[model samples]
Target: MRKFWSKFKREDGQVMIIFAFAMVVLIGFAALVIDVGTVQVAKRRMQTAAEAAALAGAQDLPKTAEAISAANTVAKLNGGSLIRTTVKAPYQGNSNQIEVICTINVQYSFARILGFTDTDVSGRAVAQKNPQWAGEALPFLNLDDDYLANPKIVAWEKTAPGDFESLWPDDYNVYFGGKFDDHSKTYFTVDFADGITVTKGTVATVKQEIGYIYGQKKPVYIFSLSSAVIKSGKYNNIKNKDVVPLEDLVLLQVTFDSFDEQDKNLFLTTTKVFDINKGEYPTDYLTSPGGTSATIVE
Candidate 1:
């Protein structure tokens, strides 16, 4: 028994056993580190790819299949595969939102020695569409009986001679106001039968040339003329050179008379012209305190 005890207590080869145990621990720890790091990197890549794809998809959501294609393309570019994609439209508006899921399968090199295979990396992203006028009210023009009561009488000329005699009666007061500022070159001409009495009031008309200079797609003017105002008017041959480039031009003629108080419809006629190079105008006119019109006369 003493001999057996002596042999058992011997320190020979004890260090070798300890070294083998430590090597096993170190190898296990290294395998864990390798597997965990690989998964983290793959996760990051999946997240970045998903986000970009989702944003691109949201732009065309609720309209076309282009969005799904875009998302898949982005995911593939980032070394990930798109698992699924979905898009939903707003309940009461034109906006839409999208969501995407992506996955990557990564295999560990050194960790495989420890019975580890491949790890799954996944990420999700969401996005939405935005409108042009999301939170603001649009502007419009307003006309009522009060507008015509203070009508400004500008000269009226016939495009061709003998178009017709003046329709306004002379008893209606015809007030010839001074010419608009040089900026307002389009003059208004009034033709009325004899004995018409136009009371002293402000007559308003939109300046013709001013609209052109402003470079607005749809240009309109509002003016008023007061009573008992007249000045010597000379006819000047105005050339079309003063015309400014515009997408659209419109003229609204409103006449107010003694019966204007009872008349609800005061608009006479509206003239509209379109220029292709000027740019496309909104299909619908903006409405403000004034009013909004769906269609403009062409």
Candidate 2:
């Protein structure tokens, strides 16, 4: 009986108890790693969705409803079911700024053992519209400063008689890549290698501008060009130029009103010109607040 009591008091099973406790700790550490990894992935997904939603929303800045709608659409498209989205315009007292916040939930794997079903993750992005951009190329130029006179307008015309230009096949082959049967009416833009100045009512300018449209396969912004940069061996100087809008001396953004072929040569509509730095606004005419873009301010 004494031997039996001694055996019972012995530390023979202590290792098993220690091992059990250690296993609990080990399982906890594994769970921690898994939960942390899952949360990290969730955070990344949320961040991506947030950025996409923010960009989409910023495209329609100052229009709260439209911005929210676009944000939601992009968030879902990015595979993140948003828990919330906030669109704030005039962010930080800057009328050109827009902000978007997105939130999502992450389901737990081994974390469920710790009584956690899911964790919430959130990401925020801020976008701003700037009035200036450098290096990006423009395929179209405004005939006049009508866009500046009324920056709210989304459609405009030269209001002068000219031949209807076809944009498909030829222009697409030259400037825009991947030719499809686009029957869009083509308008003339500043074809000058230097965007600083222009000669009014110059047929040579029109022809040169048309040549620009046909010269490059794709119009892209070149942000690396220095002020002294030479293109085609010609120095691009924007120091002082008459007839060029003070705002457009650096760059221009022009979008045609439609892809449909128009036989008419002259028309007057809202200004279709915007800054390349500012993203393309909706063509639906949502009352543009003037010159906007998507930039992360925060």
Model 2: per-residue Cα lDDT over 162-196, one tens digit each: 31111112121122222351212122222333333
List candidate 1 segments past 4 Å from native: 1-13, 80-95, 133-298
Off by over 4 Å in 2: 1-12, 90-93, 132-188, 194-292
Error of 1 at 167 (Å): 36
Model 1: per-residue Cα lDDT over 1-298, one tens digit each? 9988777767546777888889878888887787788788878877777777766665555554676776677667765443333333331363455566677678887777778788777777766654221111101112111223333322222212321112222211211224543432222222211211222212222222223222223323222111111111111222221221121121233322211222211222223322223442223222111122111011
Evaluated against the true structure, the overall lDDT of model 2 is 0.46
Ten residues in sequence with the least summed lDDT for candidate 1:
133-142
Per-model C-alpha RMSD? 17.7, 11.5
TM-score of 1: 0.41
The Cα local distance difference test for each model comes to: 0.39, 0.46
